[model samples]
Target: MSLIPKSHPRAKSLLIREKLVLGFEQGLVAREGLLAHGRGEAFDYLLGEKTNKAAKQAIKAAAAQILLAKLPIISINGNIAALCPKEIINLAKISGAKVEVNLFYANEKRKKNIIKILKKNGANEILGINPNFSTTLSGLDSARRIVDKNGIFAADVVIVPLEDGDRTMALRKAGKIVITFDLNPLSRTSQTANITIIDNVIRAVELLSITCKKLSKNNKNTLEKIVKNFNNKKNLSDNIIEIRNNLTRRSRFA
Candidate 1:
């Protein structure tokens, strides 16, 4: 295995177990997997990996919106695998949502691996498209997306953490309410989502879990208000411009 870069800051939570398990699926690939993982890590770092005021508010609002769903699915990606597995499962459970593995690289092999990893990390009730016992998602099954028949059509709301653009677009076209966490804020995935959290996955999941636990029937209207105010394209454009201008202003020092 290639050595960790010298410039990398050691993450307190990503222990040897996390690294060993995650290193392969992420490190094993070139453009397809690891690249996305690394970029997400950067976004996580930028957001300080903590639930700030804005994030908590978003989380509460998101929870209220999510609770309104008849068939809510919590979609996980590779970056999610590398960051917060239990948190994702826990949040979904608390919110009365279903946990399903979804990735850009759709396959049984990767899907199974994701399941195995999540289960090892205290995850139960992991859902899949193919309920067949033998099919592995990351390794065994080609595309283990058993949640929806076609692109989240059956879903009223889909909580997609660290999503891919293609799937997000397809879900939108299917008219599903798509909520996601995105660091870049300018990517198509962010632009197309119903609610976009401009923060790190670790922090985003933490807040989401907290919000769901504190949520109740009484707070439904509050959540509706927050969600009602959310517009993906507007939020994406605003954050993207802010990030770009920040980068440009800093370029003078370089």
Candidate 2:
């Protein structure tokens, strides 16, 4: 990682870029993943590079959904493995969600690298590796359709950060509650997910973990109320409005 000073205005963003770059070099992130991160970064700029109120609402709802789920699974890809492996593990631990490596650019070596990192970061059991347990999810042609029978296939809720659109739709079609962290509120992944946190994955994961811990003490009825009260469409619309407000505010300075 690069030694970026905290005083730098773009330090955090620069550090994230460095992590992805290093991940690409270390075979933990694909070149395509770098491109995806760049795209998300552009939206982050529109979002003022910070978590907004809409995102916080989504996070709270997502935590409630995860807690209410009988079987929750957190899906991991190479970019996620490289960027926030410890956060992933912590979220899984707090939410009692199973950790699984499910990548769009699926490959054995990359899977091994991701699993190794997760294990190194205190992950005990990760699913979505063995071919014997692999099952194809209906309605998707991407490599992401292949999921472990015990993992995503059977999960009641799935937390898929940095996810693809088709898989998000497919997971929804499969009757699983899907949560995602996407910088772009307008993306299909954001629209398709049951709860979309329009915040950077690194920050969103930690927030979700913390929210899960805080919500864990609540009764099932309370948790269900939180989930039921949330409306994804309304939240996404609010995020769009927020972006417009941000742009308008910045235009004054310009």
Candidate 3:
């Protein structure tokens, strides 16, 4: 029944592209989002579309941060919503965090459509669409500057999957604990995040959701310990080494 056959050589990659195209057609993703998805797919291919050990560790750290925060908010954009709406909603429910729609490409209609998609996927409460509820993340002039007063602005911890660099820096400057999913470990968003999972957003969110659910029964002390022991810089370095090793192995064969 699927348009992309399961037996195709590039089935996984093609499916990912198809999802982004569908997202754009459904008004759940921005036009620029297709381009971003392509960029991420390139890295995903290099990484073999597998969650590396370092990325798994980062996911654990992100889960711990979510469990440890007094008020955690999951920041959603069009790409994220389109790709993993149900996963995001499930993670919020498991972690007891709020869901807020925050798009870098700001548009009222797109925002509303994203919210509708999330709601359909079981997001009971969504924020970040009210003009009256707007607040600025200081030292940024992008569309990401606008945030909800009670969403990203008020939360002590925030999860930003498929994030932009400028907003990642601004969130850290605002003194919020930031977690991000970025394919490029060398990217600004990865470097700026308090915890960066160097994996595709789909795998990152799925792993984060599972980890959060597993840690749900654990106490705050356990969660805090996990967060305290995570090393962001080392994780980034490990991912870089992974990519290099893969390339070296390929070059030797060639």
Candidate 4:
């Protein structure tokens, strides 16, 4: 009955569930975090991962906006690589968006390792400097964290999946369009984002691919139409209300 010990047979299962939930708030993901644990248990019980209808709609809008972009880029972090590397690469190829490796580790060696993993998986054209170099974000994913008026700043739109908070907030302040994935509807990363998908990373990525394929023949006006209709704040607020109402109803029933 002791919950404090990892030696318990169910400890690993419980730990994974907890981490998956925690990953949303902390922006630091570890195997033992709550988000990891929750996702594992969700899959175990929900028959292994799925995306809902609302999420698919969001993905369609995302795909259209991305396809219409002249130069779209995806910011890849360690968590994304671990969960959905292949899907990320496929999406990049389809959307014609470049991939950039970004992480929270502010160390040079860590940067090299992360880039190596990305390159081996077929990513080309890495940008390490933003022309406004500072010692602040140096260890925050290696290769120098510089935010100039160029680099990431030059991008019209950026898709940053499984991202960190500080950089995301900073990016928005600098006037960049940011789209991100955060499962928890209440998390800052989700709320702060221009477009947020409240679904598991794997499910979101796969659905994103499907939407991209559908939008392949779409013209600019059509793509813009999709973008014009997707209300990021509205979707997020709706999702939060739905989740909360369901929880309240379940409590009453119990």
Candidate 5:
């Protein structure tokens, strides 16, 4: 029942792109989300569509942060809802984090549609609809600023996939432990996050879920070490070096 062939070389990634397109037509994704997905796709191609070692370490660190947080919230946008509804739900369940819809192009109609989609995907208590239960994030001036008072606003740790730079900075300013998935290692979102997984959202979330499940059984000290040892700036720099090396080698061969 999948849109693309399972045997296709780029099947998983193509399916992700196709889903975003479908989400746009269904009003679950915005035009900006489509363009953002395309941008991520180009980076994914450079990443070889595989999770690198550093990304895996970052994923483990992210899982540790979530497991250690008193209140962890997974912030989902339209593109995330359209592409990885089930994966988000599963990550939330495994990490004991709450699922909340936080979109940049905020609107009641699209919000409701996204809520319905999340519910259908097994999310029971979706947040982000109650205007009464909202708080303003001071550093951001975009539609992404309004967050549920009990969700992102109150969370000790937050997982923000496909995040914007402003919100990532604002969230950190608000004193929340931020975990982000960004293909571009040099992006502000990636650089600002406490633990930045430089990989595709689909691959990152699944690995994160697995890591969380495994780490859940480990001692608190062990989890704490994982978080303490993660250096977001260094990780980003290393990935950028890898990208440059790849390009350099390709040019020399050509």
Candidate 6:
């Protein structure tokens, strides 16, 4: 049972921290990931800890992009695995995207642990584990460069939730459409992505899955239109404005 009461003002945030702490204890999260989450949490606070209109727009565009893609892959890491494994699987199922584990702090044990949790959450074919099938993504020297031959390497669209800037740029350079979830609209990952959902991943993943299901019935032309009308730069700019507006509102009550 969660020690955090739902009535607590910061209950959700506290629970997220608890999960990451447990994930670290389980060998599913790196120490670096914990620090990363703290950074994102600060940005989350700036956004009023809620999904904004701009993020919803980006999610819709992202769903359309995923549906239109010939090959879509959702990249997973320790933080994502710890936070929302089931949501990731559902998004893949709804969007026809493959699930692949790619980590910055890659290791066999952690990979197995992430895969194990994913499988437990209903994922059937998790990739990026076997070295024999791993192919190097040019322009990246981190362990994240090693991608499954049949997954991110060959995918046309990739949903990298909580991604790093270098790999996002590398994927874009390799002629792939990159979609990512980031709290900070100014981050390179947010700017480099073809579609950027500026919201908490725990909320964004579920919202994306729901959006994909709703958009699945739309015609190809409609989906293409949604994708075409979206401008990542503008969407990110709107998010920054939302943060500024939110901070201004909070200051009034202070």
Q: In candidate 2, where is summed lDDT lowest over 10 consecutive residues?
A: 106-115
Q: Per-residue lDDT tens digits of candidate 4, residues 78-101? A: 566545567888888777888765
Per-residue lDDT tens digits for candidate 6, residues 39-145, read 99999999999998999999999999999999999999999999999999999998999999999998899989999999999999988887899899999999899
TM-score of 2: 0.98
TM-score per candidate, chains pooled: 0.75, 0.98, 0.96, 0.73, 0.95, 0.98
What is the C-alpha lDDT profile of model 2 across 1-254, one tens digit per residue?
76899999999999999999988887899999999999999999999888889999999999999999999999999999889999899999999999889988878898888888899999999899888999999998989889999999999999999999999999999999999999998999998999999999998899999999999999999999999999999999999999999999999999
Of 1 and 4, the candidate ahead on TM-score is 1
Scored against the true structure, residue 196 in model 1 reaches a CA lDDT of 80
Tell me the tens digit of each residue's lDDT in model 1 across 1-254.
34555456664434422553554545322245556656766655454555444555556667778877778888776557656777887887788887776655666666676777778777777655455532322222224233444224467898888777766776677678888887766678887787888777666787777776777555557767767876556666656565566567767888
Worst 10 residues of 4 by lDDT: 130-139
C-alpha local distance difference test of each model: 0.65, 0.93, 0.88, 0.65, 0.89, 0.94
Q: Write down the TM-score for model 4.
A: 0.73
**RMSD to native for every prediction?**
5.4, 0.8, 1.3, 6.9, 1.5, 0.9
What TM-score quantifies how close candidate 1 is to the native fold?
0.75
Model 6 vs. true fold: TM: 0.98
Error of 6 at 24 (Å): 0.6
Q: Judged by lDDT against the true structure, how good is candidate 4?
A: 0.65
- Model 1: how far residue 162 lies from native, Å: 1.3
Better of 4 and 5 by lDDT: 5
Candidate 5 at residue 40, lDDT? 89
Ordering by lDDT: 6, 2, 5, 3, 1, 4
In model 3, which regions exceed 4 Å deviation? none
Higher-lDDT candidate of 3 and 5? 5
Cα-based lDDT at residue 83, candidate 3 = 86
